[model samples]
Target: MINIVYVESSLELVPSEIIRHPSVRRNAKRKGKPPEENLLDRSLHHWAMDRLDNSEKRGRPDIIHFLLLEALGSPLNKTGELRIWIHTVQDLCIYVNPEARLPRDYNRFKSLIEQLYVDGRSPPNGDTILLELRKININQLRDSLNPDFVIGLTSRGEPSSFETLSKSLCDFNNPMVCIGAFPHGPYQKETASIMNKQINVYPEPLEAWIVNSRLIYELEKCLNVYNSQKIL
Candidate 1:
């Protein structure tokens, strides 16, 4: 069984700092504007963009939806061994139930996230699978979860292959894969410091969902826990 942890996930509702994005730099160049004068200057100006106004354009963490689809397709969901967490930029980590059947409407999912950002806590929706929102850091996660191994996906790490990871991790009992959920700048240094190992599966970066789904799929295969054969 494996738990998926998304660090510095861009799962915020609105007013997320935008200056961290490469596009902001590109936009500045196109407009002949000087680089961000400083963090304070950028925060007051370019970083003030709201992601809620245009989620797709800002690259919100919509990957949560697809992560559910793929995990539920495997035996991992039913086994009660699958877990997920979204560690936001503000350290407001969202814990999601692997067994929770998500609403078919994507809007419901989006709304719940927005509400979390506003409320600073999980809503009291009856039987909402979004279990809890806690103020925690990477250290807390590692201490509480006590995973047998941890792997982080980042471009700065050594190039990785699924076959190599699966083989190397075969001896471990429980593993958690960390992928940054943001669409912009690289994950924070604090995140990299906590990982047991890091892997750069692609020559360049890939979307979070692509990296997540493929990694989980390959891990499921290696562990002999895929659901396909069980149905047959």
Candidate 2:
């Protein structure tokens, strides 16, 4: 099994400076856009490379990187809140059957983006399509993949990105964990109100915070339980 690390960040906020390949440079030149020169991009690139080096020493494939962007700027120092903002974005890398194909509907999402970039056409009414997809509800998603565990991340009120998956699979009674932490600027709260026993938070420098040993074991146990459940 492959371990998945989901980063909470957005695609747009990611700086292009991290791209070191000559091909990327050539492409940018062809497009007549200036080369990327962003600190975050370089930092991410270094972060990934460091992970790669560590993996190589262990005689294993490098860890896959997934960036989940929340709000662009939410530094702990700026917010003065110690919330473990779980809602935000999720970047997950999972192991799948190489021969297994993604559902056609997944490609529809990609096609919308491709049309925008390649053909300079607007996406099909996204809201209408999303509303239709939402109507499918939880059971359908459970039957589709039968994932080992469904990690749910959420912020204050509305559904965050990770909440989308958990809401979709609520039928499985997936161990829905919500961390009530929002990024800095406006939404930062004094103290997070705990609702369910399953929901918890960690200290600031949220990304660097390591999972507690006991909590890690608990998470593993939960994963096993989810895996053993009967799919609808």
lDDT of each: 0.64, 0.27
* lDDT of prediction 1: 0.64
Per residue, candidate 1 scores C-alpha lDDT tens digits across 1-232 of 5777888765543243555566556654664543342211222233445443433233354556566566665565565556777776655677776655665576566555555655554556664645577878887887788989998888777897866776666667778778877665666677777798888888887888788777766776766765445432
Q: Write the per-residue lDDT of candidate 2 for residues 9-38, one digit (tens) a residue.
A: 221111333355554455446545443421
Question: Could you tell me how far off, in angstroms, the CA of residue 117 lies in candidate 2 after the best superposition?
Answer: 8.9
Note the residue pairs that clash in candidate 2: 6-91, 7-68, 8-68, 8-69, 9-68, 9-69, 10-69, 87-154
lDDT of 1 at 100: 56
Local lDDT at 146 for model 1: 90
Q: Which candidate leads the pack in lDDT?
A: 1
Candidate 2: list runs displaced more than 4 Å.
Answer: 1-8, 13-27, 30-172, 178-200, 208-217, 222-232
* TM-score attained by model 1: 0.72
